[model samples]
Target chain A: MKPSSPLGARFRTAVLTLSLAVVATLGSVSRADVPVREEPQRPSAFGATEDAPLPTVAPGDLQGLLRNCDAERERAVAAQKLCEQDKTGVDFLGAAYAALWIILMAFFALVAIRQRRLSAELATLRERLARLGER
Target chain B: MSASSPDADLQPARPGVTWMPYVVAAALLVALFLVFFVAPRERTMGEVQRIFYFHVASAFAALIGWVGCAVASLAYLFLSARQGMEVIAKITDRLAHALGEIGVLFGTIVLITGPLWAKPVWKTYWTWEPRLVLMMLTQFLFIGYLVLRAYAKKDVAGRKLAAGIAVIGGPAVYLIHVAVELWGGNHPQVVSGQGGGLQHPDMQLTFAVAIASVLLFAASLVHLRMRHHAFTDELEDAYLELSDREDARS
Candidate 1:
């Protein structure tokens, strides 16, 4: 197995595995929930102060460009922030799905293996009967 | 398969001139060597890309196994119509089950090694990429196949039910390749993110060797399973022949 994954993968697995382990271990260790601090919500760009362009605009297409430059910059910044959030959201969901499956399957396999010998005995009896029918 | 007695010549790890599994083992070794020593390390992903050999190889091997199941299932359905069936029916049936099991086994390796390989590259266990989804679906269907095999009685109706499900196997294989292509179209910059239209020449060569070695391995598996099936069938035939002679004497 390749041990070192790329940055995006490391971030997701680390985040998810860490989150799951923390939740599982902490809840088992102590009853109290860790209080997560929330960041103050920033005002949307529509509510932000409008910044103006410098005084070097000529009478050509330059004047029109400068006029909406601040609004466009605000929109681009907002869009980029949304992209980062969307990326994280995708990682979160993917990690959760994978982790849940791995954890649950590992749990099931660990538990089921103990009963495998019983199943083998049943199989032997069935095989015996099939051989008996041939007689 | 040869003139020699199968009971003496055909068992795995037999002393002297047994070559099947050793050939398989040698092929695996060379495949591993080329992947590790010869193939240039990925500029972006480094050594972790080495897992690519086993991952893709197992995938192809699993495909071959699935195809065997599909063909055997089809033949079985047709043969059940005739009476006085020969060893072909029983042997094919046993082979179908063998290939199906091997498919699942290799698919498990692909799935497990996949996440490990993906982690270093995609930095995540999985994404909602169409390719990933189809692979999971394929694995689940194989699991269904195994379950059907496990429960089905050695009777007419049981075989029909298993055969019916096995019919869908072929289409599902086609869908997986198509799904990977379509998924790549939608998510251009995600996972493996290499260009060359997803078929880099170096990557293709490694994969080709991977396919070849894996096929050789699969052939070895099928041959061995066939031998086992045939030997056991021979013993049954021997017992029947003995009983017939006893009846004649009576």
Candidate 2:
């Protein structure tokens, strides 16, 4: 192509426009392929400067976080205490009922043993008396 | 068979009502069911309140035993001096002794169950409360009667003295019942007919069944003891007669 020809100049201009369009499309596709990361919003308690992120906790915020942690711990402890109380009540109830049954069974056993022994002794005495009568 | 014959005067009487044990067992099983499942958990005492059914039931059974003992004792004392009433008086004495022993057994159960219930509810096993003290005293009295009867000589005077002790202890049941009313105590008087009855029908039903079961059980035990006593007496008399005949022959 001639350096100053009108047709050559027109063809060069079209080629430059096509190259720019291809570059723009590739750039957009590459941008879409890469995931975008979103930064979390800082609380109002922190300073307003976005570039210089606060690296240390503020005094007031530290105390508030500690208080919240303490509250969570106390709630858990209270729940545990209630559970222990319920378990204790159940245990005592079982003990009381078991004691009653044991006492009753013991008494019944004593009576049964005594009655059996008495019957056996009576049988022996009757047998001996019958032999004596026969003699 | 002459009245003088050892078997004629001392034969054990057969029980007329034999179905009591079956009824008692059925009632007790129902009572256990109602107490554990049907009754509501108490507001403050929780599961410990279930003990109240049997505790009160045993107390009532003890009262029945003591009262029966007292009546039999009075009868024996009244009839022992009459002519040709020796056999009946002896029978009454045996009944009185049997009732006293069973009364002591029920009383022991009441004492044990009460302390067990109290421990969880009151945070202490025992305290010097009026109702508790009176109940303990009543228990001691019956225990004393049993000990005396066991150790005393087998004679009319000894029997009379033990019978007197029983008559005195019988009135203690009334005293124990009124002890809570007369003097304030921690014991709850739910079924006193005055006020503060059980709110739930299930609790009331369980209470009723427990009482019926304990009372019937006490009666059954008393009958067993009476029969045993009669047989023992008959055997002793037969041995004595046999010995006498051998002595005469020798």
User: Using lDDT as the measure, which candidate wins?
Assistant: 2
Model 1 error, position B245 (Å): 12
TM-score of chain B of each: 0.77, 0.90
CAPRI rating of model 1: incorrect
Per-residue lDDT tens digits for candidate 1, residues A19-120, read 575477447646654333233221111111123354555668766677667667875786566455444444543443354347436633743552354345
- Assess candidate 2 and give its TM-score to the true structure: 0.73
What's the true lDDT of residue B47 in model 2? 67
For all predicted structures, in order, the TM-scores are 0.55, 0.73
Model 1 local distance difference test score: 0.57
Off by over 4 Å in 2: A1-86, B1-18
How much is the lDDT of residue A123 in candidate 2?
A: 67
Off by over 4 Å in 1: A1-135, B1-17, B84-86, B185-205, B231-250
Which digits, one per residue and each the tens of the lDDT, describe model 1 over residues B1-250? Answer: 2222222222222123278768777887787677656665443344555565666677787777887788888887777767867456776777887687667766676667666655534555555567666666677676666566555534446556667667678677777666755545222232233433223455556656767887787666666555544544444444454445447555
Whole-model lDDT for model 2 versus the true structure? 0.72
Local accuracy by lDDT, each model: 0.57, 0.72
The RMSD of every model to the true structure, in order and in angstroms, is 16.1, 37.1
